[model samples]
Target: MPQESSHADPAPRLHRVVVIVDANSNPFELSCAIEIFGLSRPELGRELYDFALCAAEPHTVMRDGFFTLTGVAGIDAADTADTLIVPNRPDTHVPRRPDLLDAVRRAHARGARLVGFCSGAYTLAEAGVLEGRRATTHWQWADGFRARFPGVRLEPDVLFVDDGDILTAAGSAAALDLGLYIVRRDHGAEVANSVSRRLVFAAHRDGGQRQFVERPVPEVPDESLAPLLAWAQERLGEPLTVADLAARAAVSPATLHRRFRAELGTTPLAWLTGERVTLARRLIERGEERLEVVARSSGLGTTANLRARLRRDTGLSPSAYRRRFGTAVG
Candidate 1:
């Protein structure tokens, strides 16, 4: 909701992403976290974060004993993190280490951002951090999550839940989605897109999308929205409507809406408007001074609409956004 910049930055203070590795933790989600937050992007000529992996024990066995991991920081490393990724182990019935839970509670008390990938939401709920807060976990564990923590609002269907500082992803793959969303929030859409390009992943998949589509593979492969999305992205400056998108896709408006819901779990109009907002934010970050020009270029029509939408999505007015992120060529 309130979430880069062009050119090489002057060694800005990087964010910290400290991950608490648990015994028998699933490595896939941890790998996803590493790809998005830990790895340095030499292509960008600046670092995004100072990352570390902290474990409660000196020798932690991974999922199904695939391997034993060592040589990472201790659990106290979490206390120093700006944003901490909680542990995600596949065995939800097994309780986590009490000290680890204490670390989580301490992190929350200090206002550090917390994240849960897949079954890691259980850890947050267990530590009482998710009490009366929104979260999501792998759909298979949804019923158990609700039964255990009824006070927590569990959005079981969505790919991830971004409830302010605390966030959760529904499954391992959705870990990447949540990570990308965080990148978009921190660096703006342009930098996020650049990261997504390197990952070869879709730039943005909003949290509202269903964790898993009803059909993993379509009966008719050509019915996917990838082509339509590509076509729409290139023309964000144009006044494109749902009807226009439908016509281009050779489907009726009703069909388009259904496909959008099925494929993306969002309406076509909502997707188009979101892309426009991202475009406008990018323009502001890259030194667009004229609000009217940004509005028209992003197809948001007038400056009045631009101000409202930018504030609605970012909690920052157009000029304020420029001040915060603008890279002016003086």
Candidate 2:
């Protein structure tokens, strides 16, 4: 049975996030929610999210039997949350709690954005929220999930799937990707990048979980591409061609292309363009720099080019981006 909590707010708004915890929940997934949403980031100069942890049952013992969590609010907390997060359950074979599933359904009915991390997608599927919708789970459980929820359109290859109001992440680290993406979508790239920097994690990771599924342990050669990548990053302000990268790496263009595809899962030009956009965004966020200067410094070459690229990358003009994210400097 679900216990009731008196902590429910009378007025609810965006930025209210509730994480649902159940018996045998994965601690790491719960920790991801806590670290991403629950932690206060004063650097953003405002309260970003009002976060809470809610349980399906009171006085629940965690998967690790030694730990007993207490004082957590109940499923009612989720009813008013603007964003409801369901962390990964310990096992897909475990039975779904009816009370928690009902809470999820109700939250969604009230227009709360629902997110599931890792095997937490199973809960959403069990709740029928993922029915006829595209979702993904840990690749290891793909067969079982498919067998159980034949209605779900599962793309086990990707790191995460964002289906408008409903989002699902594939596995542990991918949870960070999805969380950061949400932050980026709601707030902006600058805030998300700040949070990423604080966490010492990549602001964005290229490719998907499929890259890791087969080669769980990725092999990098002794003469790895790290040095070449470092070299390219430092020279992002310059016009870099595949030939230039190949020359720097002392390898032919064909080999360099293969290396980039294998290691980064992207072409040299795409990666370079992304880096340039990142540099341009930082410049825009830091201070009041002229668009021409920003364009030149970021290697976009011209104000018109910068406008196009900025719009393409972030859907915001240079001036608009600065207006929104340039208040804080680090």
Candidate 3:
């Protein structure tokens, strides 16, 4: 008998991500999932996820029968998924298949993170997992969603909602935003940025709405807020105020405020605070040990402030977060 070679060390388990493909599902959102989680990335020097698509039926016709999706695993794949992407059905009036809903409920019950893209919120709600959970769906269907599922707290204005185990993204491009966010959450800022660069997408998008656009009409645009944003990012260590930001932009504070709301859908002070908090998170993930130093470097100013902000944004204290995501312990 031939000698048997010793087995190599067991490979590490990659996170399993399964997307549910159902009838009338939009191909755009499905493509978003494939781009984000399914595609192999040799450029990243590692595989990010074990991705699969599953449906109640083997051959399902897609949105308006644009195409038929086949060669996918059966819906039972949801049982083994670490994260489940719910179906993104466009027809809100049509009910989801019972088996698909049951799979979603089982995934939720097993504590697998569940995601809904666009009208996929309808599927999650239909599964009864989104009752009282914070979520966002297509803005156009907000009224109908509210009327149907009064228990689910719908946030229509935002790009996405991250409620721990359950997440939802508004229609279309918001799917990319939420997907990038999940990448950031699971991997880290650097990894997420790399993936975004590959996709030609913004890694940490600041806002969702073009609620308003402030610029010169019938003429060239007055100015883009990009320059101001770049300047602020460079000076995050300093104690910068909204007024200082306005002055740097060479505009009155009031005009700056309007522009902030119009372009970013957030107030100036809120944006500044958010930026600082983001910097603080990056610092923590980089294994910065001193809480006060992380706070001051990020312009959050105090250890207490850093702790509060970290808790609010990450649901973890600074130390806890470092332990979870840090490359090396300080």
The numbered model that scores best in TM-score is: 1
Higher-lDDT candidate among 2 and 3?
Answer: 3
Instruction: Write the candidate numbers in order of decreasing lDDT.
Output: 1, 3, 2
Computed on alpha carbons, the lDDT of every model, listed in order, comes to: 0.89, 0.82, 0.86
Best by lDDT: 1
| Model 1, residue pairs in steric clash | 3-185, 4-187, 4-188
Q: Which ten residues in a row have the lowest lDDT in candidate 2?
A: 207-216
Question: On lDDT, who's better, 1 or 2?
Answer: 1
Q: What tens-digit string does per-residue lDDT give for candidate 1 at 1-330? A: 532456576676678999999999999999999999998888876677899999989999999999999999999999999899998988999998999999999999999999999999999999999998999999999999899899999999999998999999999889999999888777766778778889999888778888877446646646678888999999999989999999999999999998888778888998998889988988888887988999999999899999999998778888877876675221
Regions of candidate 2 where Cα sits further than 4 Å from its true position: 1-14, 64-66, 207-222, 287-295, 301-330
**Tens digits of per-residue lDDT for model 2, 196-310:** 9988987875434343532234466577677898898898788888899999999898988777777666677777777787788878877847988888888878899889988
lDDT of 3 by residue, 1-330 (tens): 998879988889999999999998999999999999998888777888999999889899999999999999999999999999998887899999899999998998889999999999999999999898898888789999999999999888888888889988888888898998898788766567678888997667653453124444536665768889989999999999999999999999999999887776777898888789878877877777999899999999999999998887767888888887776221
Score every model by TM-score: 0.92, 0.82, 0.89
In order, what is each prediction's RMSD in angstroms? Answer: 5.6, 7.3, 3.9
**Model 2 lDDT, residue 289, Cα:** 78
Report the Cα lDDT for candidate 3.
Answer: 0.86
TM-score of 2: 0.82
